[model samples]
Target: MKGLRKTITTAAIGVLAVNSLVMGGFVSGAEIVPGSLQVKEFRYLDKELDRISLEKTGEPDGTRDGHLSLLIDAGEGTEIKSIVLKTADRGGTDTGHGIWTTWKEPSDIGKYLLAVEHDGKTLNKTFKETLGSFKGVNQFDLYASDNNSMKDGEYYYLEITTSAGVIKSDVTPFADADTSYAPVLIREFSWTDLTQDKIGSAAFGEDGSTDGHFKLKLAFAQKTKVLSVILRPTDEDGKAVSAGIWRTNRAGVGWLLGLVQGNKIINTEFNKDVTAPVGNFRGSVTLDLYATNNGSIKNGQHYVIEVETQFGTVISQPVEFGNKESIHTDSTVFPFKTISLKLNAKEAAVDEKQVKLDVAPFSFEGRTMVPLRFVSEAFGAKVDWDKKASKVTIAKDGSKIELVINRKQAVVNGAAVQLDAPAITRNNVTLVPVRFVSESLQMKVFFDEGEIFITDAKEQ
Candidate 1:
């Protein structure tokens, strides 16, 4: 009454579309759409005025001029609390009033202001709908603490005026079959597609049959009551599995009598609808499972699917059918694998000191050679070249070595020595074999797996 402002508009869309919302700010875990009200359990109040269809009259533009009114009796300790505009049926989105609603509760003595949030700015626009006490959103916390709480068995009524505008659906109005009955729906929590989180292996068993189970990441938008999770096994081409093939249910026994949905590690059943103090819209729970489809599945059939529901499904694209391991992240796309190489302090020091060769090592005349200046300097050696003589000299620890390009011999410490591989230039790199000089300079070099490891054995 005080702050209530009416809205005038004309547009509406309709669908059983799937949607989800995240919960927050609740006494339990996360605040969900208030639901604990039983819509499906209405028993008609055994009277002519119990429950009635919402008469929706509209214009040519799908606009409608109608009103939804509810008469009820608040039992002992009960109150006419907050109201939620539902956007969908319990199954999925089918247009309901999904918006900011303002209303006043009527009493025999006087009418009192109760709730009003619908302005142009503050509408809960996620289009999420819930039907119950999802994440511990208390009933009392919804409305302002005032005349909102009604006395037990006292009757009160409220009304909403729908302007001539596009309209979809509203809450089904009902009179009291049971004056004490109340049930509310939390909003749509999530609509998950586990195609990417699909992971498992199918491989040849001792009997030459395939053995493995598929795993999926099942996350709900709300803590939902899971009714069914059906996986249909098919081939790479999505054809039915051939006969004579079977999969076991974990013990490699029982011929996998059935498909079970549960977190085996925690030994908790995932198929069962979760009650209070249990579910939330936080992280995920793994749904690991194996199915036989009444022993009709075969080894050739590897892929399976989660039957579609109000909450979507688990699915993926076809791949080369084989006995292999597969795992997906989210979205059921390709699995991105990550690798890490751990380098400790000592190894890190070597890495920091190792010269980054301008190019990879190459072989000439059966001897591996490296860039002279860079490789030599990496090991604390000084290298210089004489352009007039086409000669390269290396000096380290007072030992001097000299070599001429294309020559097969070298002078080390003023002593001439035979060279199996001569110094040469290829691709602008003056390459040389440091085997003889390095060993002589108290250094050890080893090559493996296409990499060179050098260790200085000299004492500083």
Candidate 2:
């Protein structure tokens, strides 16, 4: 028994001596022992854990302490092939450990090692987290009922957190709609109220009927108060029609305020302060319209007009209005058989030089206004000029085209073609349609008055 004990003691001493020598060599930067192991990697075993409630009730009722996910990595020269999980608590009280973990297949997450020093000896554990190919959501949207419940606003929010970071989106709140009303009848003309005092008709309309254009003759009582006109056609429900108000001069000069909603018109209160002098001024006002509760304008249809006070809630009665033909022609006197004009050219010497052409009549303005057909034909387009409204339409291959003269712009097939010069009415003849100037040079044009309009359509 003594011999056996002695032999065991000697073997243990030899092993200890060798281990100590290796440790010393490594610490002193000398060569390492043969066949010594080295660590090579580190990583977290799980990329992400399921969302969990942090509120703890001491029972597994879908709530618990914040769970910790483990990170593992390998040290230099050694890969941690496996790991085991264990928990410790300094106090004896029972505390929650994370979900039970076991050795499993390494995941797509890169391999890494966890290291700890115990009595100057390094121990390593490997960690890897699972990863999967991401597939985008089929439908992802955030919506809000109201941003502000009391003030008619829109409000909503979305929140999300990922390994990359946390994210949030918000929408503000708003109020509800108010009551609405409409003027079913309107009329305006030079009038003296019960006082028989001369006053511009800021608000007037014939009562009890919705027919015939009620001419509005405005006589400004105050130059500071501009007249605002509104026109709407509505169903018995008081829903408004898509209608527009226009101001014109005795010379037929006019301005269009495109299809405007009556409610919004009242809400915005536009044109209530335009200055006009008190005088016997006669001008035509036309109101284009859409059906009540409808957003579309009826081509070549009747409309209603309503004029309102400059600084009051009073609305005019509805006025019946009509649409005159936008174009007319008088072939009785051939104004032009031959016409000639200059094109828009930057440099006369460049390839972009303007093309000048002459056609037959030579009768317009005695100076020979350019023929609409001749100019459009030069640019490979068929021309159609409306003599009544002074509108010119050009087309190529069955699709309508555009023409712009000086200050006039025309639409061909739903596209606006603007001009640099005003279309002239000379010698009882409409000189030129604007579309000729715009479409000829392959340039874009836009109209800016009270509103802006744009168009770009070319055949395939």
Candidate 3:
């Protein structure tokens, strides 16, 4: 009760916590670990009624059909006995005698809001058995009936009886006066192929007979509305590939093709809204990706699943179809070159091969300066000096850079770009800022512990 307190407020939801009870329950050498128990309030609308009929409100009268959902993630070797919910007021009472023994069928549980699916099956577990049965994160819905509903402004707390002892949640209102339930999408996992053997991997066959499947495990907040889910082919950098790669002349290879729930496969047409179960939020769906004519996915192609929801877009990590060797030949593909330089060191390493520098790198005006010729040539750029103009030009991959001595401005491909420090002559060697030159050449630069690393590929 006397610990850290945190509060989270969103457009349609607000949660107040005490004693480190926001994401997890308060710890006093208890069985449950810290930051594992999450409780949220959601609008529990009647399944038979129109969703638009309910107005968002926080008044006591407005909470007639609201519910509280507790997401419990017990630590290893933990066992939960029962969970009790009661108002903070001293005279508050538990209409069900503070213990939930009766098991509500999955169908009955879906009547209220905050339903969820697990492994493509409707969540069917009693409050006492949710954590133990799931063996991981589990959601338990508390109905807003006369026996369990909380008043609008009343602060309520949960008493979870575990194998160790009784752990209590912080005292907080069930729902904020102004908060409503907003939909949220949390991606659990994504895999390619039918056996789910290739997680986040895709493969294509020559005849489309071995076409791959992209599957996703997505968890949503209560009342979340999805707009569209797209499986788009992309490059190694996760950028979408050229259009028409998704336009297929083959049948059954259409976009938004398959929805897998349990053992049932629901075939849906393209551009149609893929509705998640009414009250369930945690669900898994399978999408088919086949190679067809112009839309055929090439070898080494990467892809990402974009879930456009009412809230916003949720994109998964990039999944590659085949090995990079099958796409880019050794002659055409070049491995990223990493150039390492240390402060005041006369030696530098390009891909771990030492190269002698005419002048050691040093800091000037808080910027790391290196020999312009050596650094430019290290990245395969041509450097030329114009003695009359006191300027140096570096050309690489169609980009031209011109820098003048004692001038803070540099011209990059006909555009004037500002430099932090002007090129200076040190020990008869032209020194320039390493960051500006490397980044301008489309390379990434990182500095740490008196060392600088430059690479053509983005650093992880």
The most accurate candidate by lDDT is 3
- Model 3 C-alpha lDDT per residue in residues 93-112, reported as the tens digit of each score: 33332222223345543222
Q: How good is model 3 by TM-score?
A: 0.31
The list of candidate 1 runs beyond 4 A from truth reads: 1-350, 353-355, 458-460
Top TM-score hit: 3
lDDT for each residue of candidate 2 in 204-229, tens digit (9 for 90 to 100): 22222222223333322211122333
- Candidates in descending TM-score order: 3, 1, 2
lDDT of 1 by residue, 1-460 (tens): 0000011110000000000011110112212123222111110011101001111101111111122222111211122233433322322333322232333233222322222211011122121121111111111111111121221222222122222111222223222222110000111111122222122222111322323345555543222223123343456654544333222212111233123346333222221211111122222455455432333433344554332111112233322223343332333221111111111111211322322344455665545565667556656789888989999898987978788999877787777765546788866668776444444454544332233334452110
Candidate 3: the clashing residue pairs are 12-180, 24-36
Q: All models: lDDT?
A: 0.31, 0.24, 0.45
Query: How well does each candidate superpose onto the true structure, as a TM-score?
Result: 0.24, 0.16, 0.31
lDDT of 1 at 407: 88
Off by over 4 Å in 2: 1-371, 402-407, 427-460
